[model samples]
Target: MTTSRTYEDLVKEAVDASVDGWDFSWFEGRATEERPPWGYARSMAERLAVASAALDVQTGGGEVLASAPSLPPLTAATEGWPPNVAKATALLHPRGAVVVASPEDASLPFAEGAFDLVTSRHPVRTYWPEIARVLRPGGTYFSQQVGPASAVEVVEYFLGPQPPEVRDARDPERARARAEEAGLEVTGLQEARLRMEFHDIGAVVHFLRKVIWMVPDFTVDRYEPQLRSLHARIESEGPFVAYSTRFLIEARKPGR
Candidate 1:
């Protein structure tokens, strides 16, 4: 289907596409990425069904938490973006989860040792001290994080080869050390390298626009030459291939 489309047509279609929610349904036929083996949402739901209190951090549009079959009696979620906050509130309130507007890197607004469980999916940054402070003595923090060198192909394609620091930013070992330093014991950690394929330039444009941090300041007008070149490559060679790294980490507070 993409082979029959023009670059301008595809780019315009992607640019006009609305990235209203957290789900990747928009990339249905244009692109595809392998899912991590761990079914994070289902796993989180199993835990939430038994917990007395729980909190979800950086809940974009409340998509994942809202999918839970059962929620804790006391459930809350935090989101930094105003638009996402409103969206999350709307989606979560019916499920009995209150949404709070809080920055991802800032201290959580809840009282210390408030929640029995905390969760986040692909949080841009995790503040270990703050996470530890908000959890009860025996509470757990479970998250699926974007691991180091994730989608490096896309990043390098646009901004050349990056330094080792940039490539190693979200190291799982560093996360484990930080959690341990904050008085939490690391329980489980698993990682996966997922294959990603972009069938056309439109999907690439939409992806970069949705995941803004991938390019920081991505603009079609500014990156037209690169986009055009990439479009030509895809047209002649086939779907552009890339890999995304992800990790699942679980940490628990001691002193039960």
Candidate 2:
């Protein structure tokens, strides 16, 4: 008897794949997501050009920072994951940037007023007080964050309906309030809900693996039933449609 390739096989393959360094290129044709109207990379590049010193928190592989046309004289990035720290160091060292391995919740290692600009893309969680402490007077903190209920459709597929409070946990307004409390003046805020599509079960598995927060405690064994159901739905319904929410926020410390 010959065994046919099943959804379980596809999911297992994805689960075993590497999920390091925040790169999403593996999903090229398997999945797609709309970009925000305001280009985050472009905006970050523009800001990078003028700042004298900068820090990027949670710099996953330093891919985005390395793409900037030019970096400031002194630039540093922090990564909580060791794999990402090594990857970021290898990628950024050539660009004259330092990559520090730090825990996500630990205090920033740099001294007070060390950087004129601080940035992050999809940071796990923003440490507002630490950001304020590291930024010089008049320094800016710019980031593109995952907003409330981001990718809820995908999350709900595995876990069922989430409570309103759980869905609203990452609300932009709450973030703004925190920033204010940290003594940073909110300068710019923008939010967008972008379309996302998963063409195959493998793509969904890969995504859940890479973005662990999307479906906390996800495992091929644990979610096999749900994954199989989703695979069947995709086979019959074309693709799995979901929405991702993103927010761009810029906060500035007082004084020149």
* TM-score winner: 1
Model-by-model lDDT, in order?
A: 0.94, 0.93
lDDT of 2 by residue, 175-253 (tens): 9999999999999999999999998899999999899888889988898888888888888777799999999999999
TM-score of each: 0.98, 0.96
Off by over 4 Å in 2: 1-9
- Looking at model 1, how many pairs of residues clash? 0
lDDT of 1 at 226: 99
Per-residue lDDT of candidate 1, residues 1-256 (tens digit): 2388899999999999977659789899889999999999989999999999999999999999999999999999999988889899999999888999998778899999999999999998999999999999999999999999999999999999999999999999999999999999999999999999999999999999999999998999989999999999999888999999999999999978
Backbone-clash count (model 2): 0
Looking at model 1, report the run of 10 residues with the lowest lDDT sum.
Answer: 1-10
- Screening candidate 1 with a backbone cut-off below 3 angstroms (N, C-alpha, C), the clashing residue pairs are none
